[model samples]
Target: MSASSITSQDLSIGQIFQNFYRVPDYQREYVWSESDAKGERGEEVEQFLKDILSEFEQATKDGAPEYFIGTIVVCPGEDSVFDLIDGQQRSTTSFLTLCALRDLLVELGETVPSTLAGQIAAQDTNWQGETRERMRLDLQYEDASGVLVEYGEGRGKNARREGTRSIRNLANAYDTIREFLSVQFPSDANGLRRFHGYFTNKVKLIRIETPNVSRALKIFETINDRGVGLDAMDLLKNLLFMKAKQSDFGKLKDVWKGVTQAIYDAREKPLRFLRYYLLATYDVDAKLQEEDIYDWLTRNEAQTGHGIDPIGFAERLRQSALAYQNYSRGRNPAGGADHGIYNTRLLGGSAVKTHYILLLSGRHLAPDLFERLTRQIEETMFVWLIAGVASKDYERVIVQAARNLRRATDAATFAKFEQEFLVHQKSLNMQMFRNALLRLHTYDLRKFRLRYLLAKLTRHFDVLAYGEAGRESLSHYMEAKNDIEHILAQGADDDAKLEFGEGADSFELIQRLGNLMLIEASLNRVINNRPYSEKIATYPSSQFLLARCQAAPLTIGVNDRITRAIQKLDPASSWDRSAIDRRQQWIADAALEIWGVPSPNPKATSEFEMLIPSPNP
Candidate 1:
């Protein structure tokens, strides 16, 4: 291999595009937009334009020095061409701005600079067909290419078509440039000329050229080391491609493209998925950091007698990506009733990523065993979260659990694995879990957390009391919009205060989980702060356990714990502090049953030791 040569030089807009620049097929599309989804001016694009226009205005009186726009890194290719490694967004947007200026010059009957007009489209026989006019800045994807070609020809439209986000964004950028120029110059040709000269000459970029793609990408990483400007996954992808033999590049690229498309909605999917993949596939320790994943994979591949080939590794990544995607979307790759239920109930929350890593690592297990393990993980996480376990503690426990679970070879091993690792480290067991629930002030939790608790209760109530026939799927309640209502209203008026008794500590009771119910948000406003009699009258209309508060005879059901408790509470009685206390105790008991914690086994020893020193010590 030839030694890689690196050179950096300041380049103006005109000088940068003088040579052919091609965005490789593996590159992401033109994702720059004029405005965000909210119709607000895009931060990056607006800043770029403002900076350039301000520089142009200043140059009219005092000649401005070169304004540093950003950096561009490219690899020298065959026949004086270059493959763009970074700075595509900046280059593409600049090209669009030039095209807009060229068109405006022609529209005003001013002599358009031939060099400026020539930058829009270049005639190249190197293009597959007979000599054809192509955009100077060629994009990888069809939608962006089409928009670029149309815009370069002065026929671009602002209306979005049924296409990818890139296409819409391309069109939006062109329109943005045109509108910006028109608004800044109005009908003055002199202002347009002045702006054009400054944009072409003053705006600058540090062009870094390397002899090979690998070297260029290294420079790309070095330049973006301080920020997430370059995704870690993108760097890993380039590394994998660089490692593969030239003969296998096409095959490896195809496999990688398929894997990326499968998880396109997941931003930085490779970084996350690959970490879990390595943790599960190898016998790594519990502290497997995400940043070390690439180096770990490389070291593992270099090991004697256990090396993974590039193509085989890529294929495994493809398969694992699909499984990871399924788990992320709460779909069961291994179809079963329990698997479905576990995924549906536990998959949509803040702690979902922890579960995803565990599930992804154990995806190869039998459906039944996988379901059992899923429940174990969910239960473990529930205890940890409710106990307010420190983040570091939770991560340590979960990572260790993932390592142990991934190493399990069969159902027996899996069962034993749970027994060993699922024990509470510090304050994270049934006793602590129960205490946490009893002391949990619902209002103290963020709205989403409170809603999650109520949603879980709603699901548990349906299964325990209603059975299959009267079962109302609280999946919607869990996943959708549901209001958390205070049974004893937060701002109870004088009438409601008198009904509940005057001396009652309404504030203390109002925040308690026992005093809360999940009702449709639409009904909360209507039933707000009513007397206990009126509130109980509205209960029968609800699908949740709140409806069981009606005077009708309680239905005979299997696990009627919560429903029976509600049945015992008299609607005619004042909903005072005493009522709140009774309901709070009932809720604490139900929570224990809902999120079951394993009892200590005589044969098992604690696998995890808490880092915190005991108070007695």
Candidate 2:
């Protein structure tokens, strides 16, 4: 052996990065700080700063140079480089902090220390007498492979958004660190300089280096649960190693890395992944919680086949993670656009992530069958939301259905699963769906549900009518600023009332599902206050086909979907009460089909269809 056991050195943040790091592809992504829709920052990232700032204050008063943060385990590698086995998250944050400090110091007009820039990336003449440099942290993982270098080169903001969760987290962490620095220093340049000095020189962590990856991983498993502890993900990895034989550690670690990286790339949580895996593989109906994930896995190791074949289980998990990543990115097994998979994300990024249980349950099925399952799951979720089915009730149905879904390995079985379980006709009443459609307004959960509904509606027609959005992913619609457009202005003018009648002035009419459509926010802002006559012309400018369908000339295609729905709408028909009813009725008819709700009253369809004029006869 190189030594009796291993070597350890306590080093400050500045000292640790003196040698560059390459985070092996198996490590988790930069997740110490994640920004979600709920406006919550990563608790650990925030706490990282809060705790450090407390130490910074005392260290400043005491003029101390060593305030320990945590530990990092690594395997020594070629040429002053190290393969980071543990503490990539903390190390990545340290690298980012260097970037933020330099950027913020420049923004605040403080002289950046020569050492700070050198820590991020060293500049020196090589043996050939030419200048060469490299970033201190090199992330070799997919998803955000080149992002660290981009930050090092001072182009962090320009990092592309390909729906890569790691890039988003990295960008968010940089901004968060910059913000923390600004808040702590305010207008005092001297205070800012002092804080930077303390951060680089005082913030310390223990670096553990081993001769090999296996040794480093073992060392990591030992101390990771203590002091700025590792997340459930790390502990689970340790659990996998514990159950496997010595000869299989490398294989187990390889698959485990793929499992974790896939989940991280998808922007999903590891514990969430573990919980869903348990459900899809073992107890789909058990009220498993995320916090209880490790405990559940340990208890059910034998039942889940993990104890029998831990390597095989990891392989299965790797497959599930790959599927989860595809579903997260809105791709089907065949790598084609699956609206069913896309709509869940378009519904709500993380809120509707549980919808993946169905995806995971039937992943081993044929591509067409898997596609059918996703579509059915998407429809079931919509119906549940529309029928005002309680979340717990919806969860119950999907969870139990997922257990049976794994058995639906063929077309016939999938059809049976769809009919017996996914079809929610009995639970969702036609009239209930109709009234729910009428009652739809921006309130309660409706804010997100309404966006999801409108986005789906626009996407459905866009694909059906023109076949244009076929090339555009749901992300284009999702990332783009979308607004819930009100056709009738809320503050009714005299012209609006006279053109549409007295009831058109009512807030209820203005907020109705029929009157509302999805439009790009920029377009909405321009026409938002205009009257129907003035706004109808600008509807053609909207990115949304639904919004553009107001006038006949807005479209040129003779596609039968829109033509039969309304054979070239008249350019002269102003936005009016009759139009709102017709639009609402159109949506109600589609809603029944989309969500698989029971048919509306037969007479009602006839009454609604009459609003669309007949062809010359």
Candidate 3:
């Protein structure tokens, strides 16, 4: 944190738009709902209109009553622009309102206000340095694709509806406002004009401007505290306490404390753990969102056995939370890192923990069988993750697998479930996995995922050459002080561009899996953007086999596997686009085996009831 400067000013909606505002790339998409909106989502757009109109109606003829539309936090940027941090929902909605009013005035054959047009869009420079009129509410996120500009300028009729989430939501918000305004004012141009005047002037908002986005967010957090999960967990616990007799309060308290402690120790959200426990252990027909848990629990108390045996439910949670703590830390019951726990934890994306909904359900399985199950689950799951399959399909099947595990009495019963699990992934074979890897570009991946993918590929090859010692040597990029080397440099110079030029596609080609390798950062700094002919000497000493094999006469831990792996490449020859393709093909083959889900046995098919559930959506 740095020494920060802050200022607050009360401004009307119209005056607020005087200074340029931009939604940064890091900010989330416009997700406000028109209907089914509650709490923080403005309780439906109609409520926003009704409330403001109500405030306006309360005027005593002396002056119109000012309606405070809440506060916005922003950080100042160059050219009098402010990088909007908090309150984009309100600001974006207000901009849409202005656009709607302008359109209404035009539709009613009245003169459109030039000031209103300025509020919607102003002069700006495109990335190519060409001057153009871009929307005032510029959504800089990749998925937005200038949706705000298209809609705000009345050019959205021909715009694509099946766009990304942000585009769809922005369009919906604009239409919702436009429709609401039309219905409210009917065809009266005067009523629309008066409302627009009142909206631009009377609807006031407070702006908290800070020096930077981080500091602005820090101040925003100070003003507003977050405890949604904690509050829900507390409420659930109190409900249990209220139901229990006074004599059992102490016992219940002990159970609750153990549950919370296990979760806290595991550094997991307590509510998520509890919710997952229910989903894993039983058949939950409904998609159990966090907010829906309380009502669901209260309504189905006796059917689920939680109401009659609060203590028993608490005990189950306490036990599962402890096991979950182990799983979260990539550990088995013996506190070891085997059973692919580390690999499971390393998988990228938010839904990674959903597997626990099954893992905890099968806690009673024998240790060796449990390890096999973990491996099976991760192997199938990782393939799905890499293939960009929707998680909803995976989660539903995982829930059913957990229940099937609960019904398992022996190794054969568990083995039957595993067979079905493999059979279910019949579509996710080597062909699909290889094709998915073919499209992989490291630049498209998140930071952690990119590292995980490279590190994983490096580790697998390294282990084959260097054995167990290879795992110990990884300091990311599979060695200490190494960087993810673009074997073909990212330089945009004419010679660099012509190296593997596919015209416009050449730029993206450089980021593909084939063009990248792991090299020592020290060596990399020297030959960072150098020609392949100049950079090959440094590869001989590189820790990564993937890079080391590229150079000739490899002597460090040389083996048949390393030799066979690099059979096609000739270090004496020049590296170019063709070389990148061959290297990527090698990586793609490795990926198929790494993420392969084994085929089901011919005889094992139809030997038992198929327990894998069909995906709901």
lDDT per residue for candidate 2 within 433-543, as digits (tens), equals 566675565553446567778777677666666675453455555545887778787866677667777587677778877787778888888886677888877888876
* Candidate 1 lDDT, 51-78, residue by residue in tens: 8877676664657767888999988775
Backbone clash count, each prediction separately: 0, 0, 0
Q: Deviation in angstroms for 6 in model 2?
A: 12
Candidate 3 global Cα RMSD = 19.0
lDDT of 1 at 168: 66
lDDT of each: 0.67, 0.71, 0.69
Candidate 1's C-alpha lDDT? 0.67
- What order do candidates take by TM-score, descending? 1, 2, 3
Alpha carbon deviation, residue 209, candidate 2 (Å): 12
lDDT of 2 at 254: 76
Indicate the worst ten consecutive residues by lDDT in candidate 2: 608-617
Per-residue lDDT of candidate 3, residues 1-617 (tens digit): 23577888999998898778888664545656522222222234556777888987776657898999888888876555788877777888888788878888887899977778877777876567878776677677565777787667776554555567566666666667777888878998988888887888899999998887556656554544332322446556645654666577668867876787688667676678878888877777527776666666767777666667888887887888889989887776556655466566666444478888778887888888888877777676666666665667767767766777788768999888876664456333434556667777876566566666777777766676656653742335534576787777777445555654553136677788887776678878877676666677777777667677775746434557666545533343466677777778877777756555444444544422333322210
Report the alpha-carbon TM-score of model 3 versus the true structure. Answer: 0.56
